[model samples]
Target: MAARTRAIVPDRSAGIKPLNYNFEVKPPAFITFEGLDGCGKTTQIERLAGYLRSRGEPVMVTREPGGTGIGERIREVVLGQQPAPAAELALMCASRAQSVEEIIRPGLAAGAWVLCDRFHDATEAYQGGGRGFDREAIAALHRVLCGDLQPNLTLILDLDPRLALARARRLPAASRFEAESEVFFARVAAVYREIAAREPWRCRLIPAEGTIDEVAGRVREAVDDVD
Candidate 1:
C-alpha cells in the first residue's frame, strides 16, 4: 500500500509531489479524520500532523467542537450530557459552523494543511444514526450553518464496538457520546460502517484494532495517497 501511495500530487500550481514528496504551495490541503470512541482518531490526527510538519509542510492540527474560542464553550455544553439530544446536536452543528468559518476555511486559504480530528461524521454517527434523530432535519441545519463543506478526505477508524467501549471506559473523563451504552455503541459503529460503505470516494475505513503507531501508519497513507 505504501508503494501504491506514491501517486497523489495536487499539480503544478499546488506543488504537491508524490509521497515523501516535499513541495511548497500557496494553500495546503484539507483532510479530516473521524472514528468511533476509542478508535484512535486523535492519536492518528496528531501523528499525521507531526509527520507533515517534519516533512516541512505547514500543517494545522485542529478539531471540531473546540477548534475556536466560541467553539470550546459550545463543546462543553453539547458534549456534557446536560443538553437534550436535539439541543446538543444543534450546538454541535453551530460549533462546527463556527469552526469551519473561523478556523478551517482561513487555514486552508493560508496554505496550511489542516488535519481535523472529528468533523461532520460525528453528528451523523451520534445524533442522526445513533440517537435516531431526523436525518433531514440535521442535514438542513448543517446546510444552513456550514454550506456543504465536507472534508476532502475522511479516514474512519473502524473497530469492534466492544473493544472500543472497553477502551473508552478506561479513560478518566469521557464525553456524553463515549458514556453511551454498549448497545448504543453497537448502533453507532453500524452507522459509521454504513457511512463508509455509502461514501467510498470520501470515506476510507482503516482497521482500528491495532496499536497507536500501527493506526497512524494507516492514516499517513490516507493523507499522503490523496486519492
Candidate 2:
C-alpha cells in the first residue's frame, strides 16, 4: 500500500513545533478507537490524526469493516443486510483480515502511525456482549484472523447508551446497529468498559460526554504518554 497523506492547515497558535526526526527510524504506533455508534470516535480520530500530522508524525487513518475495497463490500453487507450473529462475526473478521494485510501491516512497516476506527473490540462488544455470543470464541477468531496483531493503544470513548443511541438515530441514514435497542447498546458499552478495565496498560476508557474540544483535549493527554 502507498503512504496516505493529507494537506493539514497548520495550527500555528497551538505553539507545538513540528518534531525534527527521521520517521524511518521512529517506531510505528497502531492505535484503534472504539465506542458506541455515536460516541464521536470518527471525529476524535480525525482530530488526533491532524494533531499528530501537525507534529510531523506520519499518520494513516483507516476504519474497520471498510478500509480496503473488499472490506468495504463486506461492510455494506454486514451493516445493510444485518446478517445473523454467526455470519456477522465471520464478515467482520473477513474485513479485518483483509485490512490487516492490505492496509494496516503495510502502513506500520513503513513507520507511520496507523489509526483505525474500530477493531476486534467491536466484535467482542457487539457480538459477544450484545448478541450473546461466547467471548472465548470471539477471541479465538480474533487470534486466527488478525494473527496476534493488536493495537498499541486502544482509546474507547465511553458514553451513556441512551444519549449515544439518540445521537446515532439522528443521523440521515441509520445503520442496522443503530436500529438496535437501548438495552443492546447498554450491553455493548458494558463490554467496552470491561475491556478497558481488564487491560489498562493498552486500553483507555475516555469519557465521551463533553464538547469536541474538551474530549479532544482528554484524548491528547492520553496519547501524550504513548512512546
Candidate 3:
C-alpha cells in the first residue's frame, strides 16, 4: 500500500490579514493610552479595542517598547535594567522607531484602528518629567524618529501616583519604573496632565478611579466623536 499523504491548512482566523498596499480607505485612527504604571492603561486599551471591534471596525492593538520583535528586546532592557536617563530615552526612541516602521504605520496604512498602549508621550512623562530630561530634546528626537506620526487620540488615564504605584506593586513582577519612589510617579503624572493641557485637541484626560466598566465608559466617550 502507498503511504498516505496529508495537506496542511493555514489558520486564516488568527492574526491580521496581509496588507493592502494600495489601500484607498480614509486613514484609520491611531489611538494611544497614556498613564502611570498601573493606571488601567492595559485594561482600558483592550476594552476600547473590543468595543471598536464590536462595531465592525478593523482594530489592531499594539504597545510601545514591545510592539515588534526588536522593540520587545529593548523593552526587557529598559524595564528590567533601569538604564541611565539618556540611555533609557534612546532605547525607548529606538523601540518606537522600529514599531512605527514595522507595526504601526503598516497597520494604519491597511486601514485598521491601531490602539497603542503607550507612545512617545510616555517618554515625555517618564524621561522628561520623571528623569529630568529636557522636553525639547525629547520632542526633537521624536520628530526625527517618528517623523510627524502622532496619535489621533491620546486617552490619558489620570490617577494618583500613590494609588497607581500601589496597584502596580501588587503585580507579580515589578518593573524598574514601578520601583521608583512616589515622587517620580508624581512628576510623571504631572507631565501627563501637561501634555493633555498643551494638546487639548489631541489628548483627553480621563479620570481613572472607578470600576472597569465605568472607566471604560469614559474611555468610550472620549473617542466617540473622534471620527
Candidate 4:
C-alpha cells in the first residue's frame, strides 16, 4: 500500500512566508473518522476530503453501513428501528463485509485515499459498550469480515455525550443509536476512549468541544503528525 502524504513548502518570495502543501507522496491509504452522533465527524470528513482533493489527491469518501448498494439497505434496517442486540451486530458485520469487499478495499487497492466515517470500532463501541455485548465476539466478527484490513489512521472526536446528544437532537431524523440514553452514549464514549488509548499508533483522540475551525485545525495537525 502506498502512503499518500502531504508535504509543506515555504514561499520565500512572499513578504510573509506562505505555506504550500503538496500531496504527491503516498501517506496512509485508509483513514477513518469516528465519534458520537453530532461530534462533527461528517463535517470534518468533508473538510478533510476537500483539502485533500484541492491538493490533487484521489480521495474516496464513504461511510459504514451505507457505502454500497446492499449496505445502504442494511443501514436502514440497522438505524431506522431497533433490533435485537445480536441481530444488530450481525447486520452491521454483514454490511461491513459487503463494504470491505465492494468499496473500501478496492479504493485502497487502486491507490485512492479512502476516508470512512465509521468502521469496526463503531461495533465495538455501540454493541460492546452501549448494548453490553461480548467484546471477544465482536472482535472475532471483525476479523472475519474485515480480514487484515484496518485504517491507517483513525481520528476520534472526543466530547461529552450530553452535549453531543443535544446537538444530535437538533438534526432531523435521528438514528436508533442517536436516540440511545445518556448512559448508553457515555458507555459508547468510554469504549472509544479505551480503544484510542489501547491503540495509540492508529488512533488519535482529539477534543471535540472547540469551535469547528479549532477542531478542524487539530484534525489537520493529527494528520500532519502521522508518521
Q: Best-fitting candidate, measured by lDDT?
A: 2
Please provide, for model 3 over 148-185, each residue's C-alpha lDDT reduced to its tens digit, 9 standing for 90 to 100.
78787789999999999999999887788888999999
Model 2 lDDT tens row, 73-144: 999999899688899989999999999999999999999999999998899899889999888778777887
Clashes of each: 2, 0, 0, 6
Q: Model 2 has how many clashing residue pairs? A: 0
**Model 3 spans with C-alpha error above 4 angstroms:** 1-27
Write the residue-wise lDDT of candidate 4 on 44-108 in tens digits: 99988887888888899889878999999999999997788899989989998998999898887
Q: How much is 30 displaced in model 2, in angstroms?
A: 0.3
TM, every model: 0.85, 0.87, 0.87, 0.87
Error of 4 at 104 (Å): 0.8
Better of 1 and 3 by TM-score: 3
Candidate 4, residue 14: Cα displacement in angstroms equals 52
Q: What's the lDDT for all of these models?
A: 0.74, 0.84, 0.83, 0.81
TM-score of 2: 0.87
TM-score of 4: 0.87
Tell me which residue pairs clash in candidate 4. 3-26, 3-27, 4-26, 4-27, 5-26, 5-27
Instruction: Return model 3's CA RMSD, one decimal.
Output: 13.4
Q: How do these models rank on lDDT, best leading?
A: 2, 3, 4, 1
